[model samples]
Target chain A: MKLVAVTSCPTGIAHTYMAAEALSEAAKAAGHELEVETQGSAGLDRLDPATIAAADAVIFAADVEVRERDRFDGKPTVVAKVKDGINRPAELIERAVAAAAEAPAASTPAAAVPAAGVSPATKAEEGASWAGRLRGWLMTGVSYMIPFVAAGGILIALAFLIGGPEIASKVNGGTFDGHTYKGVSDLTLILNQFGVAGVMFKIGATSFSMLVPILAGFIAYAMADRPGLVPGVVAGLLASAVGAGFLGGLIGGLLAGAIVLQLVRLDVPRAIAGVMPVVIIPLVSTLVVGFVMLVVVGKPIASATNGMTGWLNGLGDSNKILLGLIVGAMMAFDLGGPVNKVAYTFGLASLSAGNLNIMAAVMAAGMTPPIALALATVVRPKLFNDAERKAGEAAWLLGASFITEGAIPFAAADPVRVIPSMMAGSAVTGALSMAFDATSRAPHGGIWVVGLIGHPLLYLVAILAGIGVSAASVVALKSRRILVPSGDAVAAAAPSSRGVVAA
Target chain B: MSQIITPDLVDLDLPGTDRVAATRALAERLVAAGRVTDLDGFLADVAAREAQMPTGLEGGIGIPHARSAHVSEPSLAFGRCAAGVDFGAEDGPAHLVFLIAAPDGEGAEHMKILASLARRLIHASFKDGLNQAADPAAAATFITQEIAA
Candidate 1:
């Protein structure tokens, strides 16, 4: 069905564009032809009168009065908040289609007003920005979750430093050293070595537990603001409760936030406006997201995590090198991105499973990108920009400290060149680390935790080898001056094309 | 010829978590920039606009805007808070805040700048550009470039 939408927010600013983008995208995705008119601060980009006449249904997704509502008086109509344009485009389209079906087209040819508006030249070019926007939205959540990952991972590593690897394995809760703990909880904790280390381990694990929920909560916050938080958080906890991991958290966060954004778009009566934010929005979003997550999304991701666990365990001794290579590639693929986190989390999972090689590879590869980029900049300073040179200086400390995100500036600047090189280097390090049977009990603290690593010297050697490879590759790429489109470099960290990345 | 957002108007380390204080801080920058004739009077106008409805947008942003006689020119002041300040957003606090002060009367420059800004805000890259600015100068430059001034 053909649909026409008018999107306007109270401020007639950002929300207007966001809603227009959402509705058009959703409509297109659902196989419906859609056009949107944005009455924003930029003035009206009116829908063509001919186009509106052809539209079978009209969606008035406006917070303020539609400038030309009288034009669509006779058409099948769906009145909604502008928020829904972005968050509930498909639903709105469905309603419009249904409304069109219900209202007989030939029954009443209402007196036609004169064709008043021209076709807009501002039909936003969506192109590659769609993927970039989704990435931005997801990263919004991940960015917030990182502090939890760092502090929690380090604390757990610290616990290992003090109490040894047994604490983590013990806390993982299963058959261990003949003592079997049935579950993982405060109540289930069996502290045979109830020392300072054990207490630290518990504290660290507790902090780590909040990552998914925080990730989910903030993602919602990004998508829909204050109303999105309540639902996003609840759904995140649910994701964990159902064993869906960060993937589930990502989906649930998106779902909860979108639902809340859509709900807020509802034009509630003045009498109920007070209760809308506090009671109605949260209640409705939570209920809808809860049902969707538990029933629809929860199962698939649960199986995925469970399957990944089994696959990692099944890798055993024979496929250790292969496992290392795979995880290493993942670590460098985005350098602390979703793929990297998946590998890191996988390694963390294996730690509790009493397998340490995965963790060893994870660390080696995670440290490779920054160190390699830093090395590249130093080896061939002319190849790098001034900013790259500066970042290189800081990369040394960040890489040594095991902060993978230090390479973000470099990777973001020249992703096509930087990422593959880093991945290749990390993969080599990972495979070599596994080949040498390197293992780590600690989750973080790069050079500082060398004492905690099994075969420390070999591990360092593996990191060095990866660093050399990456530096060589990046420097070589730079020297060739095979310049990527300047636009792509900025696309690494954000939407280089503004007013449209989100649009 | 004068830019709407200047280096001095960009505060990288805006302190505290109170929106009122944050607004006042940004307003003070405008006063210092000589864009506003009166501080209290301008803030009062901003507060009144905010009272009608908050200027906060999703994705960690708060835009407190107003048209006032106290504002001598159309000016924008950017402030970022590491420790976010509550802007009455449902999600929590706002980390990035843009204070837009427009001169009273019939000038459309402020509206045009605002519309350009509103359009730009929808893009994550623009926000990222603002976020990653090393200093106020870099931020001011970026805003000018993106707003195409």
Candidate 2:
């Protein structure tokens, strides 16, 4: 038998892992294959969906709520207390095996089944609004696309760093200030003639070219699983062909995924059903999506993209600073969560359309939180706990490197004081970066890519000002208290295990 | 890696009627070894955990533990009670007692060690070996080997 289990305890320390080990040992002794996921204070190692899909039975040995329990919806499952798993593993395994044998084999391959544990689109049952679901789907697409962004973005930055920012402008047939984004022209010629800097820029730009398709493909993948991929990518390429840009890709992806999801639900004859996912679904959905993209929504989206890009490019200095405040607030609002990703995607969209200032503002705002928090800890050491103080020491490097999540521990501990302080600081920095006429071709890489930034000195100055303002505000907020009890000061100064869970 | 437990922290013959006495005896070794900085504060933390629910388990074992600011590191001290201590397990009094101490806040190393030890305690062979060990050194070494495994 192939068995999978999730073990958790209230304290999330000892018993969670003890149950996992006991279950594993008993499963091995009983000649069964078992994989156990331990959810504890150390953090959970979640079982992959592929593993869950392939399992014969599921066991939940949790004294507390099991996270993502719906993933095991259709599997034969045995629920038991956390201690029962440790002391009676053999009995639990016996019961699990019995449960598996009593259940009928699923007719469909587990991976092909939808609407249960498969995708975020199925979360409508949980009472999520349409807007929330839409955001989840869009965030899914953007998240998968970020690696390509970081890789391609940094490589392009490196190209500029080596070849003096003008090196990449050759491939686009224009300079940064007033040129339209014509996609990269003369790719093979550029590669053959341009040497090392040319190779970096061309390779990086080629990766950038895939950004729209990947975004479209994954958004579809998030909605309708594997079957949604082909149609989604096809529509994305069509969007690209029509000059519809990233905005068109987003619309096309939603259309393709929704179309495929409904098409797969068609009840075909048993004889022909086997080919549905591979042949009929892909072929039919792709054809529909392609037709819609070529004829229906393509041109409107392209005009919207061009209009947004033209507006971004034509912004006056005051408007740019205003845009900076909104972007900065979003970056610090969640401190590297969904809202931050949205701001980042906005920058990538502008970058793809050839508006360079938004990305510079984005990077500056993103870099402010950790640096500011680190600075706060130093100015008033009594404001943070020892663990936070240690984290703050590491935050300087993390912030400078543009890893915004380095400040999560602090924000999680004291969100009310930390997040707004960070927002105020980041807003100032973002506005200053834009007002100083700073621009970046790079999507990310904070201080490391200074040489590639337009007016590097002013960019640095903006960052320093933001850090100073944020640190001072955080210290001030912490020192001046309202509803906070006198006990807050004790928690701040307390040494080890004050926050640690007792086992 | 710092040694979480040494032979000096083990007791071959521990005397106590209840879980509190047995736990304190083992904890005293931690204080003597400088693994714990404050005995009364650490004991109060352990008592709080005990009050949450009994730390007793089936198969004659009791683990009284807490994450205390008084603990210098994550440490474990062992005792073999001559007369079993009642640890609230339905099975009966516990003969093998372990006092687990973790430094306050999120320290990783000792918790991993202690959690791994908790897993190993389920095996009859491992538990029996500890019960049959000839000396304190043998008992501590047996635990270290089982943890390493």
Candidate 3:
């Protein structure tokens, strides 16, 4: 017998697809033709009306309520929890079929059965659950957001490269006058005039800036399934437009998803299902979530974000020493994970605001851990395992290029000691460079690439000092082990278990 | 006389073996129990199916089952081993065995049975119950209830 199945989960991450997979495999094994519609983070992946019509039975394995149940008024329908779909789908289907067959024919009146239309099935299939739909919408936003960071960074780099050094010159000891830099001033004019590119870049950046809201929306979609998508997207858009950025988006997405799901469970007529996705759901969700974000949540969140950004940007001059320590510690804390990204993003933003000093400090702190670790391993092989020693050799180049991720392997292996040591060394470097009034033009790379930096020689000196401190600390910790031959040490320190071992 | 059992029946003892060698050994045991007819044929059938795709299902379980003409009748020979068998899964290993034996002619009914078994396995508690089942009869009874429910 042909069967139609719908699978969804609360998180819409793993369980949704897992249930679908189980059902498909079981059906294949049982010699029955089956079609499964998955309501997941990506939205309604597979929804074929013909399959539903042809099926001898229908199974709904979901945590969230499904929309357009009226379509299956006369058909055999089995609604079970997602867990049941995973653990007992065959049993559930058989039971559903039996239940449908045994039910009185009078229970579903012929007049009550709505004509099978695309809207009801479409709404049922796509808007069946709010969480899954929300996830899909939010992911769509995130996928579009990444290009902004890349484009903005590259354009700003070009602007700085063409402009003369004086373009970076401070005005009245506070503001920066781009007019002073002749080459860059001309280039900036031309770039600013490329209205289309500027608009595209702005939109991308603005969209990218709304990452938090999008994430929230997707999370909700994953929970609520198809019906959740409409509310989730609406909530995310509202969050972005109202200045909530990340926090507001998350709240809005969740609110929208929950509201839509509640409405779907009300079991409105089949005729209304078609209009729900495009009109009724979006209108209600936006009106509710938009009002909440704008009047209630928007102001506080905007103030908080602005306050945070201001606090971060103000970490210069007076508190240069403390700021350096914090930046340095954060960079080495997760190597290149969220903490490091936050610090790096803050420093990069500073470049646009004409405060290159923080960037200089950040660049110095960023390279310290990997460079220091590499040098430490080279000077004293006893401090690291054979695998780490070999990794250190490659890390030297990464350090020189200011790729902080190079130290991840070493940190992952021994986070406790390595992370603290790297943070201490980095913090020291950041503090010293900031105190010396060092400035950088670029967001990344070592002192070697900081030729355009103010006081380039000082930057190099600070980097050297940080590297020395890191190496010394590591050596002090590792001096107990005897230094083995370089070749043997390299063989012993293979990075992965799959690495070929040499005699 | 050494009985030649097909690979179709041997592949059923998946959850009963942790390695290829163990799986082969379980296949031999099933042959001794008269649950499988031709050992080579059963193994060949399993190898062929595995080459196409793995039988690893969701919920940390795997079902390595096959059908062949060598089998005289439809049967289920289950084996529960101490260690989890590595069935070349993307995530890990196989922990449950439900070897289904059907004649090559048993077409759609075989698929229906597989589907029913798969649907029941989607439940976490059901899987746990299967793993904790005291013996083969208990496991079979649990499975039968799951299919019926």
Using DockQ as the measure, which candidate wins?
2
Candidate 3 C-alpha lDDT tens digits along B5-120: 23233332244445455445555656676766888887677566556545555445655555666655445444455466666655666666545444565344333444445445
Per-prediction DockQ scores? 0.12, 0.27, 0.04
Candidate 1 lDDT, tens digit per residue, B1-149? Answer: 58889899999999956889999999999999899989999999889878875666667878788778898777899999999877766566889998888777654445666666655765678879988999999999999999894
TM-score of 2: 0.50
Error of 3 at A321 (Å): 1.0
Better of 1 and 2 by DockQ: 2
Residue A428 shift from truth in candidate 3, angstroms:
7.5
Per model, how much of the real contact set is kept? 0.17, 0.38, 0.06
Model 1 lDDT per residue over A205-271, tens place: 7876787788788778656655777899988888777766565677789898778867766777989
Ranked by lDDT, the better of candidates 1 and 2 is 2
Which candidate has the top score in TM-score? 2
- Residue pairs in steric clash, candidate 1? A226-B90, A226-B91
Global lDDT scores for all candidate models: 0.73, 0.74, 0.57
Q: Output the number of the lDDT-best candidate.
A: 2
Q: After superposition, how far is residue A23 of candidate 3 from its true place, in Å?
A: 21
